[model samples]
Target: MSDTMTVKEAARLWNLTERRVVGLCREGKITGAKKQGRSWQIPATAKKPLDQRIKSGAYKKQAERLPLPIGISDYRLASSQYYYIDKTMMIKDFIDERPQVSLFTRPRRFGKTLNMDMLRTFFERSEEDTSIYFKDKKIWSCGERYREYQGKYPVIFITFKDIKFDSWEMSFEAIRNIFAKEAIRHSELRNSDKCDEIDKKAYERLLSGQANEIELSNALLDLSRMLHKHYDIAPIIIIDEYDIPIQQGYMKHYYDKIILFMRNLFSGGLKDNRHVSYGFLTGILRVAKESIFSGLNNLTIHSVLDNKYSSYFGFTCDEVKEMAEYYGVANKYDELCAWYDGYRFGKTEIFNPWSVINYFHNECEPRAFWQSTGSNDIISEIIAQADNEIYDRLTSLVNGKSFTTYIDTGVIYPQIKSNPSTIYSFLLVAGYLKVLKTTPSFNGDYMCEVALPNKEIAFVYHKEILQQLNQIISPSIAVAIQEAIFSGNHAKLKDLIQGLLMQSVSYYDSVGENFYHGFMLGLCALLSGFFVSSNRESGNGRYDIQLKPKNKKLPGILIELKAEKHGTEESLKKLSQKALQQIIDGCYDVEMFAEGVEMIYRYGVAFSGKKVEVMADSVSSKETIRLSKSDYRSF
Candidate 1:
């Protein structure tokens, strides 16, 4: 080999394009390379230079090639500057259907705000040619008919996603500001000769944020009328997260005020309003019972169960596959699917777009990204109100089971407590559960078989759903109980369980073993490094509870619980002993032993009303030896 090589030879050897090799040589990245005339020479033994190009937004040129847009909701910025998934086909669908008023009900962070912004960018007139954003998109290839609508209409856009407030006053102020922002956007109409003088005055008041309650309630209608007169084309109105304030109101005890205001606002702007050419609304719930869309016969709602425009909200299978390939994590597609996929919108299988994008952005490591993005207040409320039946079903879901129930996609906030069965409906709409099968019910609802969506949701379920139990059972007591269990401090564990029982349970809730089983399950479910299982066959019979460690070095745990109906202390001790014997007699340790766990802690717990008794022993596979109280240490 020669001491020096040409750029072409170096390019071949280093697997670089000749242009890149030449640039590297000129930039002094290729050691000992000299330019001969217009060609460069590199040392034969010189290795490929380390890639020093920035991947983050530290430089302008590098920002053009940034990672996935994790939290970006601005359409123009996301579509042009990030690895955007083309959802513009939704525009083509909308143009074809041409519904006068459309409502899209989907869970939060499922791209509602971004899609709304995409509509605003495509429809709103601007001095800058915004057509460039969609010219290379899926909608552009549909036909000139769809493309002709681009940059053609005045747009009134506002998002209530950030309007969460604790009181009606603050919430009303935030909503007023949102309308004022839209009014300012259409400032040209304030001085237009075509707009009526009264309408111009209303517009100026709205722009100045001095509009009264009645004026603000009619803000959307008034603004659209002025825009239509100014531009000679009725403006398209887009409201993103329209139910956010309604939810906040329901949660904060001012439901009536917000509902009244929203009803007036929506009815004026969307119902029988000639000034509005089209209306688009996105939210997590349909909120039908609220009468906000009262008598709006023209309104059409597309929810998670509907097939129309379903694939637009969340990433479809092919989209995720392409994304995985683009990010060079193709081999992790199955893992990604198991964690973020399984969301079925209509008949389209969807992946949580937020988690999927964050999955790739974090180098393909899976996590409960979707759960961490927002408050789970609704979920917490659901768990807080769960009866024994609902808690057991939720437990089944976390254990990889599905159940069939009637799902009213239009479920309202008030039904959460009054109609406990509506919890499934809430779970499905709020993105906590996924439908595996659907049958249209008699009324407008559906009979659906639903389960936790994926590993991410399962993790979220185990954490949030179980953690809410701490409100009844103090968090410190729960942690102490978990520590006692792991450390084999039977005395401490017994006292903690007894204390929790007295403090948390009502007398009616102490009647059966099922209640205690669920209570113990909730506690055991919080174990960080264990895969908790319940009522599973081990050897000859099913075990009440089993805590199998993910790491082999950690000891496994088996629990058998017994509940007595009004018993003396001596009888409770015997009952607890029987529970302990049942564990060994049932051979519950077979599963753990087969999994190569060396040590096991077997526990027997009994309850009589608030009174309780507990017994525990340890087993080692290497030798059948008992762990005396003096031999105990934290593991």
Candidate 2:
């Protein structure tokens, strides 16, 4: 069957979209395909090009296309080879403004490095005409003003992401090594005939990694100076993930040492440096307290809240829509939105590029791909420090709700410890939460509504909640409490719960009824091996908890907790009895009856800080049975 086909015919024969078929023909990934005129000509017998989709068994099923740009940071490779989303216009915007020093702080895995690489590729004069890289991109249409700036200046690009280390000395060494590598790349500067031997010797020392701290601190400033001397133009400085070391430093206990070094390096390179034309720095946190950008007077910071440059890092709605249509998954748009959308950056709603790519590549099945890349332990640590009010707010967020609070974008390590709510800023900038709405409050600070970005980030909060409970309540104590509840040892259960409650109050900083409700939820985790459900709708109303034992012979359990206002014996007794009565009136046990359980244990616990009153009873043969003297307590 020797037949020739146009791109449209070829797309139908291959069961791929025409645009994707064209990409394959252009990249030469599809064999025996050729581009002539405005379209491509392909053999009718051509097979579909293989990619990550093959792993998902898409080829066997047939009719599949995947637009996944997986971790590729090289701008040329991504645009020329893969189906890259068009973010090249951001380069035009940057060159147009040309801020002396621009800091773009965004979350991890949000395409920050790739966008920075694209910027460096378009501007840096590396003895290569990289204008060809953007010729077909959107920046190409920006006309001569932006095009003339391409590859016209020397570039000094570096990343401090590798500064992640356990010790300060080791981290310093790692940074020195990064400069050394850059020096080796620019070793041609040593070979310049105009260079004298002494100046060349200084460069050799840097290449050998023999340069000390002071020398390395000024390394970038020195490099830019040398580039200016050689090329007769100031260089563009691009730094990616400049705060990784600082963030790691805070976590690893060497914040002071790293902050000082980073501050010096940034100061020398950025402040009053005549050889620097424009500079860009991308990091997760702004590092405000350390004065990392203190000496640079021309610095402009655009954070997550900023109206400018927000859509550059993450995928906008239109971008994702076009991508879904291109990949022939237009029907999956709603599912995609629920799983990966909800980030409101500036005026645009954004989608997680990392997760979207992973989903399309893996047959469009949803999974938590971004959170697994990093532990998010830093934000969780700060969440664990939350008081009862903040804890309830976080709980509401995990339950698919939103909360408004005063947000301070300039979060530092010290502030996280002093004011725990500073974690909101950290979490916001770090991509664990997204701002829904923002309005200026009377105090002059913006009140912002934040929520979990999507189901993926919701899991992060859920994990944090469990982590907080684990951090506060001991596993051994949990087991003892479980045994007491199982054995009907009311006294032991009371002692254990009171001890746990006091610990939460004094040590964990928990308070109010919300704290008691969460504590009771944690206690109910012991019944997870059997059947346990929390705050779920059943029968006539929502029950606090319903536990049906795995053993058919054992009694099902229903628990209701009431937070008492005063800890008097009379008040506690009345509250406990009222809680039990409400549980029955609400038909909380109707779920158990429907499940065919023959017997049931019902409990009403009244709590006020460390003090608690317990009342429990048994239900058998469809009759409410009074508790014995041992099962009832009011003190």
The positional error of residue 630 in candidate 1, measured at the CA in angstroms, is: 16
Give the range where candidate 1 is weakest over 10 consecutive residues by summed lDDT: 53-62
Q: List TM-scores for all candidates, in order.
A: 0.71, 0.68
The number of the candidate with the highest lDDT is: 1
Give candidate 1's error at residue 384 in angstroms. Answer: 3.5
Error of 1 at 601 (Å): 16
CA lDDT for candidate 2: 0.75
What digit string (tens of lDDT, one per residue) describes model 1 on residues 365-471? 45567766777777777677788777667766754578999999989998888888898998899898999999989886899999888767776676667667555
Q: Residue by residue across 486-584, what tens digits does model 2's lDDT show?
A: 666667887888787676534233345544555565566544445654554455555666677777678788788887554776787678777776677
Candidate 1 residue pairs in clash (backbone atoms < 3 Å): none
What is candidate 1's CA lDDT for residue 259? 95
Compute the lDDT for candidate 1: 0.83
